[model samples]
Target: SAMFRDYLSRFSLNPKQKFKTLSRGMKMKLGLAAALSHDAKLLLLDEPTSGLDPVMRDEILDILRDYITAENKTVFFSTHITTDLERIADYIVYIFKGRIIYSGLKDELLEKYCIIRGGEDDLLKIDRNILIGCRKHYGGFEAMIDIESIGGLPSGVVTEKVTLDDIMIFMNRKGENSCF
Candidate 1:
């Protein structure tokens, strides 16, 4: 009872306020408080920050960080917002079209993929099967590729580090039949 009351106060939730009257952010905070009150070893949160303002989102993230650090807990957070994942996740699992595209350490995933950009002629020289996703513009094409798959890149092609958002977009674009 004390723990629940403490959490409610910590989240600034009014004990007298009816649930139906609470805003989305307030509701999320209440949920967070309830989850923490149980002293659970694991937390599965889906889009906890969705529709929350920046300040509130930041506060939630900080609370999550504190939760894990204080108790050696594990949090499985799923979200479309890659920036949130980048901020707090040490491991990542990417799912696309009911398929698990990747499951590994966040750093390893970042290391394994890259964005490649080059003229259309240069792009044509590369095998389509190796490309994760490709977008063609008026003069050039940009594609996501596994770093290991690149052997000797054509002269005009440039490679850049891939972000979490880039990986999601490209992999989703590839769909079911594509390979990475």
Candidate 2:
């Protein structure tokens, strides 16, 4: 079929290969090819890039990026690979333990929270209530805090932009009393 041919031309998998024997990547490509051949407006993929080599992962991402923008199709995929979301997701939905913790624009979420790092003396300047999570080492300390919660701390403390992974880690670190 034209769909399989198009896919094979790019991914280099044998069309005649037994489904049971095909590599996982090949099976994934075949499934994607079948999906693309249809007229569906929405595609739901679960960890499509999982277990794939970097090159194959890049190829799939390229195909998805193209399909999304060019075809105007919506892709709803769940990935523990937060970097993949950074590359393609417009919105983020963070669900943990059957609870929807966050659902909003990715940029907005990133802008609202950050990691603050400074010397041990800085701990006294920080308000404990404002910190979502904190680490107090001998020389320095790092804590996760919302931008709005940052009151009048002096100029020496530095705030670093957080990645999705950082957010997930800090979210786990947060206590039950968290305002999340």
Q: Which one is best on lDDT?
A: 1
lDDT of 2 by residue, 79-140 (tens): 99898888888889998778998999999989989898888777776677888777667687
- Candidate 2 vs. true structure, TM-score: 0.89
Query: Which lDDT values do the candidates have, in the order given?
Result: 0.87, 0.82
TM-scores of all models? 0.87, 0.89
Clashing pairs in 1: none
Q: TM-score for model 1?
A: 0.87
Candidate 2 Cα deviation (angstroms), residue 35 = 1.5
Every candidate's CA RMSD: 2.9, 2.8
Q: Give a tens-digit lDDT track for model 1, residues 130-155.
A: 78888777788888999987787898
* Pairs clashing within candidate 2: none
